[model samples]
Target: MSEFSISDIGLKVGLEIHQQLATNKKLFCNCKPIESEEYSIKFQRKLRAVKSELGEYDPAVLFEKLKSKTIVYYANSESSCLVEQDEEPPHNLDNDAKDLALVIATSLHSKIFNEIYPMRKTVIDGSNTTGFQRTMLISQGGQIEVDGEKVGIQSICLEEDAAKLLGDKGNIREYSLDRLGVPLLEIALDPVEGDSKKIKKIALSLGRLLRSTKKVTRGIGSIRQDVNVSVKDGGGVVEVKGVQQLDQLEKVVEFEAKRQFGLVKIAEKLRNSDFEGISKRENIFDITENWKSCKSKIIQKALKDNSIIKAIKIENFSGMFGYTPFEGIRLGKEIGQLVKFYGIGGVFHSDELPNYGIEEDDILIVRNILKVNQNDAFLIIAAPSSKIDFAINSIINRLEEAKKGVPAETRLATQTGETVFLRPRPGASRMYPETDIPPISITNQELENATKNIPKSWDESLLELQKKYELNSQLSEQIFDSRYIELFEKIVGKIKVNPTFVASILCSTITNLERNGLNSKLLTEENIVKSFQLLAEGKIAKESIEIIYESIMSGKSQTIDEALRNASIETIDEVKVEEIIVDVIEKNQEIVKNQKERSIGPLMGIVMKELRGKVSGEIVNNLLLKNIKKKLGNI
Candidate 1:
């Protein structure tokens, strides 16, 4: 990583940020913009690639159509309607959502268009039931500064978010319509040349600017980032999609830069070496007979199921597949990624042979069949007979592209921060004017109102929070960054508690709970408020809040009362608290006489051990000090 430099490679990185708006209704309908688990409507459909008005099909859509998947859509009445199901025409655009977009545009200092026309972007990936996403260009040409360097913003779009993909089984994919039609603001930044750290900083700076508006949704899936990375000498631009976490952004960029660089180097090696390009008849060989009595379970099952086992031979590519100029950068992994798109688990290349139960004898047999060359490499794929042609063609095409540098395509980011093949990059022909909704005219009065709604910057907001609550710098920043800032304020304003404590519980305690394998999301807003209310009313000690929340999250209790019972926290009166303290002091009489004031610490611990959640620690402390002092006078 230290060896590579962004400027040296002429790397260009662009960002497309999609954030869900915190609006009351869906972008095109009156349906509430929320997700629901109970779906009343379920249907399935098969979508195909359609040419735009220009009569050119999007390469991405064509790729999806080739795979041929059945899309199963699930819809709930509360969060979706006929508009989402594509059964009825869309209603008028929601004014609140439009206005919210305007506010963000104003904050970015962008040039807003007077008339906004929605466009249909073709998407046949089952994420959109209508086979397209509705997007409108609201503004264009603005810039944000990160670390004293200016990064230009290209365009800002107000769009309808796609459906949430549930999962996939075989050739069928499931999608939930509960998230469909929600309003999202897409901000595209101009491509910039920088290293991974600078790229991450730019992303963070833009994200903070968006969040400063406070009109966007929070929590997981509320915001998404799509990164387009390309090198000057290293092939084409590769767009990495759905980078949900900022911490993963740097690693994603680093790995992608190295991957593309390595790919370019491999192409150079092929050009200089005695490499004859891949041939269909010569490279694509049917090696099914060689694996008839194989020890490998995968091969045995494929043979039993009558699946075709095809292998491709690449001349003078023995060490090339396993070549890694950089750590974790290899062409074999790249080939495996492309094959998985066709529903094949993976491929076994000659570089990694004599493994996966493919004994040395089996390797020799494949080499003999493919006309053995010491420097040549071969890869085998086992799949259904119908998919053999498509799988082989796809592999041949990828290897061909390997002769060139990287192929321009969209890739999916994995949890490990590496990216894999998703689809080809869409062209300009993928978008056309949307006709369901009319063009909306933006008035000066609306722009003025939106400008007024633009909130303070992140630094100013954090400073205001500190001043208002008298909170320390760290706690204020934590609460501001946490998903519970609004709840923190509500808890403090509604209950008689220290604001700092509230911030800590929301930021630190909940995080600690999640780290300990507890789902703190189970503690709803209502439950959290109720617990604090109980604390203010002296029904439970301040120390008991965490215990009750833990109980609820751990599934030991459902309600506050039940949690209290589970933790055995009974609200003891002052009499009981003093009695417990006196009993503890009498038991530790020697310590009281010897340590005197120091006895206060040891005695308070013993007393609280018995009455932890029942009585306040403050009350126990006062009682222990007075009783200990009186006993010392008597002694």
Candidate 2:
């Protein structure tokens, strides 16, 4: 319940969504576009920011180049090839990917290009092997209805996905080649109303449209969104990257809007107030000796590691540090964003003083040395001696940016729905035509075929599923939202099973398994189809669906038959189930007589041990109850 109004800030928002295509091969190579744990090959290289033909360098790329990072790539023969290693030239663009993009563009009422050409967009973040990403604009000028308002589609581009980030272990950045060269579509939209709720709904609608075509991959990293938000009087637009979760998209946009608004207020106050010595700060102080008796583990650890601790004093910035324009976000936390760039834990400021084992006397000592006034605030940070200067300057830079209100930059999203500075936003100088990829002339026949065979809208498909499968809205939405909606339809159409039962196994059982920490994504579509086929053929009981799915996901068994055998779900008849329950009831006659129906729990446990996955528990419970009533003469 945020009371903040979008109109108050004069905010405007835009979205750039990139979704991976469900193609069998990589966009530029014959290798499969799937991740593999078995990496038999590795290589390391250093990326540099090269100037475009006009001799212009990208600021963001220059920043990454300054880091002097070493990037390591892992690849296997089956999952990758030289195309991703930057040692070989790329092949032709993927046809299936083109068809999918064409279909999507047509569905969005876009005008497809008769000829498409690829251009190389410069990147030096170690996310691309060739120092650039190959992108081709396929269509332009379309619209999609969101909340009864027409949201304009700017451009649809087909591009190769970047390398999968493995980890950034210090100076060496690791990436997997498996995700590189994977074909994905980037849909750029014009700025819309600044409403956060409306923006989230628009994103959800776009995702549904893409998924309904059944041409996009489904997973955590399969899609990513870049949100650009800005307020008219605040500052330039800032781009927030790596927003994968739709549920958090609203918060991400809202946070940026508030951040921009806060910065504007800060700049206005600084301009009008009598505050002096903000830009005239001379040097950072060496305050390590003042904290010799400090008990904070973080400070002690830094001392133990021989790291340098420094402090900087700013006048007339006391309350600004704790001024929260958004929930859970304070101006002090804003400065901490720069602190993180130096790879430090966080910054200690006067706004949150008298804690962290740093006493009031400790603050007084530092203040006396820096000669701070009542309106002044100071920052304390610990870093290696070699990086102390850089850390100090990082703080100075952020304070300077605050004076201008919301510097234009690219930021990374945190799990808490907050954004932190990643780097300066790149400009148009980052792109140059890819000479290796010649312009492709698309024919009228191509568009005609794509237009004639458009995929059904996801909303229409969901309605059909609701009617034919008798699935509740929740279950049907999950199935439609997933890539397995078509598969679910296929199973229900061919198998002799209730659609509700199938939907439960697909939706509820898989969700239950995921809640317990099992990765249900590991369950292959083929395995699911086979499991339902087994149920259709009566080779396995309906109760075995969870067991079968769990076994498949856990790699215990590759197929339903193997899963059945591994779980010891041998062929057992109703008569045998009745006999087993009869024996249990007789053996527990005294307990059954005493507890009556309450004995069902212990009796069901005893029966499930030998008959789990072999027969339905509902049937076992019914027979156990019938026989127990007869034995106890309670019925």
Candidate 3:
């Protein structure tokens, strides 16, 4: 635990959720909003930062411009067009997407704008080919309640999703245009001060509300969350981008709170010790010669590759890099994060020295060369000569910010819930009026139509689901929240299966498989519906559904027939099932003789063990009872 609670630190969090809308066409193009696996078109472009209407360039765009990276794009005609390539102007606003946004806005009680103007938000990360993203503010000012506490909605905007980043080389990044220009609905929430659990609950409430509308797309990559976290009297607001999982939201918040608090403590300690910040001229030294004869494999490899080793000294900064005011919080990790952007693996600091293959002898040599002192700390990096000065200058700049609390920046969320520096946070200078598309005016009839699409309240929806499906509250809520809710309804409507069973398998069983490290996403909607269809036709038993799902998700099989063959599961006839039941009874005659009808329960296990995926348990049970009674009469 930390020295202070969440309230003690004055933690504030704001959430911005971006949900993909299920529309038939792209937001500004006629192409379908679909991702294609195959690409037939390819092109490359270099984007540059430009002044906004106010004659100001976004700091983030300028930062990316400094890298001078080339962006290569892959496109498929089925999902992209000239608009995505920036060769043609955008078409009129997508009406279906606009209506969906209006429905969400009306449902949230937000005031919709009479005329929506499109604006270009500068983005030079290669995710956008035009060097900017087109967005429109459709409505503003609404509120949602979480646990009896109200959190305000800032604004609702409909925009185009960016292209998917495929890979990144040092000077080049590859992207796919398949996802570009897709309709996206963004919901921004006002900042709220609370603990991690409350923050997570607030996010969940917002997600559930969108899902209740049933107009948003489902599955991974269909939705993303950008979390803005700041601590009072601590660092500036930091944005963690692309958090796709709800379970990871709380962890991201908790980790960020600790990180900002730790930075504040480090800043205070530096001020208390009367330490001056790092100066590049007097503090940096080239110590490549010191590691030429080292035994460490990393050093030897770097040396062999002609990489230079540079070190930076901080006065009165001893123990600050390793200081942990909170668990897993350290300034060294911050430095490590900055170095990664420059393609450096990591940095070796005095605090973690005498480890990582750098023996005590090597540390002593470095300390002596940098002028041995108890109150000083040093960081060394091994990189190509091209990156040495840039990496060192960044380190000094970051240390300068350390004198203040946390530096304002945008960080990427990792799988482990920790955040890493991506780029400096952008400011309002990024937005300018888009001239390609005209403003859209909302009419009374359109508003009325949108109102009709507003979904029921979450609680009411869950209650209605429970009543309509004759399901328990837990099962109903599970299906209602899961990605398969729509699919569950389709399956139940098309197949002659119990609604509760369909809900359970779609929600609980698939979740269990995912928890076991299986990718349930591999099971397509057609696959599930087809499997249930087979069950309804008595070609496959309910017992075989999980087996088929597991097989398909585990990559052992791709089709229903293949999954059945791989699992050795075939639908045995009722005659065959009765024969197996008779065999089991003959093997356990003494138990049947003693237990009579009670023997059915004990024999169920034996029968299922043989008929597990081959036949239905209901059929097995009925046949076992009938045969056991007939045998009892003979006895």
What Cα-based lDDT does every candidate model obtain? 0.87, 0.84, 0.89
TM-score of each: 0.93, 0.86, 0.94
The prediction achieving the highest TM-score against the true structure is 3
- Model 2 misplacement above 4 A: 1-11, 254-273, 280-283, 286-308, 357-362, 463-475, 486-497, 521-530, 537-539, 547-571, 580-614, 621-635
Q: For every model in order, what is the number of clashing pairs?
A: 0, 0, 0
lDDT of 1 by residue, 134-172 (tens): 999999998888888888889999999999999987799
Worst 10 residues of 2 by lDDT: 274-283
**Model 1: how far residue 271 lies from native, Å:** 3.7
- Candidate that beats the other on TM-score, 1 or 2, i.e. the better one: 1
Candidate 2 per-residue lDDT, tens place, 1-635, comes to 13466688888899999999998888888889867888999999899889988899987887677566899999988888888998899998889989889999999999998999899999988899898999999999999997688999999999999999999866789999989999989999999875788899899999999988877898788888999888877667899999998877888988788778777877777767555544524647888888777777888999998988888888778877877655655668877776676567788999998888888888888889889899788888988876777667767876777777778889998877878889888999999899998999888899998899688887787887788778888888988876557777888888888888887777778878887878876788788888888777877777788888888788777777788778877658889888888888878888898899889989999998878888878888899888888887853
Best by lDDT: 3
Tell me the deviation in Å of residue 490 in model 3.
1.8
- Model 3, span 160-202: residue lDDT tens: 9999999998888999998899999999999999998998888
Model 3 pairs whose backbones collide? none
Worst 10 residues of 3 by lDDT: 269-278
Q: Which candidate, 1 or 3, would have the higher lDDT against the true structure?
A: 3
RMSD in Å for all candidates? 2.5, 4.0, 2.3
Give model 3's TM-score versus the native structure.
Answer: 0.94
